[model samples]
Target: MIHEIAPHVLDNQFKIQDPKPNDYCLVYNGSKSLLKKEGNGYALPTVAEIQKLGFEDFEGHYLLNIDERAFFLLAVAEDYAAPEGYEFTGNRAFRPMAPVERLGGATAAHIAHWEALNKFCGKCGNVTIRGEKERSIICPKCGNVVYPRISPVVIIAVRNGDKLLMAHNIDNPNPMLFLISGFVEVGESLEQAAHREVMEEAGVKIKNLKYFGSQPWPFSDSLIAGWTAELDGDDTIHMQAEELSEALWVKREDIPPYATDVSISCCLIENFRTGFTLPET
Candidate 1:
């Protein structure tokens, strides 16, 4: 839902250029991002802000653009001083950020993470170079190329009669229960992933897998495909203790409401509860 920046379009066509004065400067350091302090909130800084940090001719890595505004990643030094009114904050602060800014920040963070992981070539162990014509990393020695990683994930809402299935993942710190979800494996389809995830996580067979929608979840470098399915065989819970803290069925009226409807999983849950999901076929 964070990508729903209506009226403002994301122009992701690659362009090899340095940041201009008005372009956004997306700077990341470890788990934190440098954001311009805007009164009580934060915002992406302009190239001019980074210029004030003593890098007058800063050459930045070009990221995508929002509307007509370009964003660039600035690789700052270890002791990079924050421009006055700009602060470094943990990336978690992105959720409450304004929708447009949130999308930009999250996307930039995803690229930063990918860039960090691909510093060396997996094929020849050579230091990689950023591709000028596309969003990719290239190894100079062995010519190995790595694109930005986007793992496909399926988030399924399994319905049994009037009840919905939900589970608590062992990894999530939040106690909120979510729909059955997992990453698609090699040589797997989205539908296959949904069926396998439902059975593995909740120990239930499901049918009538209907396509819902999709969202680019930059948080985990995942493109989540939303799905709705009917509970097929058993309704018993054979919880996978290693991955799930809990899994169970809940009546429509009993499904816990989410604090914020800002994710694909949240959208799927809301649709099921409101009876807006695809009709049974």
Candidate 2:
């Protein structure tokens, strides 16, 4: 039995609230933190600096890390009360911030997506304005509506009894292997995406697709829909050079040293091999 990656854990806590004023928080671009405006220059504030500034009148959701040392704050566009040049730094830096960083990476990516895609109306090529009480942009001239876009992707752990299939991607920064995954293509269902990805990446067909769970991969604004599948039959393991660096089946007991908290690939294999899922609460 496969298991979830321990949602709602202390580190993955989703404490939803409204944005308030004076509440400084950390906003990350990949691994970098958004900086605070000091005089004409901007700088990363220490935790002590954030505590002194104060947070009030802000309302938003927040995701806190396990150690409680960091929190990811969220907010609407209207709640930002800063003067000019007080926006976030687009470059990568994860410096500390006041506990009020309202723009988590996922939320910031959504904001960027809205701004990038809503420049012109789809129907009339007119300008679009942000909607009230909702996270949408509307065009008054054409009445065309645009909402935040979420890319749904399938991530599957392909299994053949005690041995599971894992592959190394060419583009990943780390040299570790990853579970089979691909973005959901238009006109196809989630299962189709899983099948296509497995066959394309590992040259194996999978069946008995089972839905496991989901995670918000904010790094690229993707909603990862996870699943586990069984290989259709013994087949050749051919790697797609463009996508994967190597393709092979590894025993479940051999994966622990390579596991990371960032992905569900190892967790699924562990659950299947151990007969009990890891606890999260």
Candidate 3:
């Protein structure tokens, strides 16, 4: 749901160019991003504000083109502090910002994290330089190129008649209920990953797998693929103690309250709760 920035287009074509006065500057320190507090929300800094910071010789990457304007990502030192009226916020806490601002900030954070992690070439332990033509860091000695890593994840809603499966992750600090989700392992297709996750976490077989949608979840650089499936055999849920603390099926009419505008998982759950059918693939 974070990618659904309607009215404002997002173009990620790699371009080597300098920042314009109207362009946005996404400054980041490790996983946190610098955002200036507007009246009630936060916003990215303009090129003028960045220029006032006096950061010279910093790494910059063309992240995306939003509404035909460029947005560049700049990774700053961890000790970098925000000027007056500005504050640093982690990428995960971007819900308070506008939809377009949140999307841009997430993308910038992803690139910044990648840049910080790959400052030195993993292959030869030599300092790497930014690639001039693409979004990558190239090692001058070993010629090893590193790009942003995106892990594939699957979020599925298991259906059985008018009921849907829900679970609470053992590691999640929030008590909000969520659908079964897991990362795709090596040598597994998206559908395979979906079924594997449901079975492993909920101890139930799922079939009739239908692709729902996808979202770029930059919390940890994940591309979430959403799906809907039907419970195959038994509905008895033997929750995986390590991954889930609770796993159960709930009737559609009895579905609990959840946020639908934030993530794809919430969207999937909301669709089922409201009886919104997906178009055939």
Candidate 4:
């Protein structure tokens, strides 16, 4: 199972006190900037300078919240370039690097996001400074607190033997099929959330519910809780047009090549496709 690197971890306790001057700080204009190693101190490139550089060679590293526990890593494209330059490649070469390298980008991105969002103190309407022992900013005036946010979501793959249930998103760009998935409601447990999503998205009840692993889905800061469920009644799928363009059963061999290959959804589906199962949850 995957859990996001909580932002609170980056609070003062986890920060590198003697960080190298050339350490990288992930910057964002529209996309993200190249991993710029820190110099003398943490220097955020000016917007003008970022504009001058255009968009290139950059990737999203991660997200940071004011609290130490609200952090997540992501890979974003730095598609900018400076004028008259040799067309910087940003960090495309490293965009799909190993998870370990990507981890650094995530940390930098999270911290940068936290710092940028905390420029002013909401409580005192005064200036805020980054706390040395935590990831939050301290207001010199009145004391109020802020933190990063995380949205929990469920992604499940419904299986009945060698066949799998899949759906095409009602609002997708391509006609790729996807598993039933959705966000958890305010007052729902993870299991309840999964069942609710399956029912709402596919109009089918599930049984033999088993908790699968998890993945840090940073596209919109989602923690994907993966699961496998047994289809109820007939294999016939009743599509929810508001939520899906189409829904159907597909044989494992007929599964289309994934559009976004790096997702827990794919992982869960593939596991079932290959007859792999974890210790029954």
lDDT of 1 by residue, 17-36 (tens): 65679888878765567987
Listed per candidate, the RMSD to the true structure in angstroms reads 2.5, 7.8, 2.3, 8.3
The collision pairs in model 1 are none
- Scored by lDDT, the top model is 3
Minimum summed lDDT over a 10-residue window in model 2 is located at 93-102
lDDT of each: 0.84, 0.60, 0.86, 0.58
Q: Runs in model 3 with CA error above 4 Å?
A: 38-41, 56-59, 171-174, 256-259, 279-281
* Backbone clashes in model 4: 43
What are the per-residue Cα lDDT tens digits for candidate 2 across 1-281?
01122332234333443333333354333333346666654554433444344433332234344334344343334334443434555422211222222223334444544455676888899987766655567899978888777789998888787787888888776677778888999999998999999998888999988887776655555788888788998667988989888888888787665343444555665556665543443
Higher-scoring candidate on TM-score, 1 or 2: 1
List clashing residue pairs in candidate 3. Answer: none
* Residue-by-residue lDDT tens digits, candidate 3, 175-279: 877899999999999989998999899899998999998999988789999999999998999899998888889899888766766799889999999998987
Give the best candidate by TM-score: 3
Error of 1 at 28 (Å): 2.0
Error of 2 at 135 (Å): 0.8
- Candidate 2 positional error at 84, Å: 17
**Candidate 1, poorest ten consecutive residues by summed lDDT:** 255-264
TM-score of each: 0.89, 0.65, 0.90, 0.66
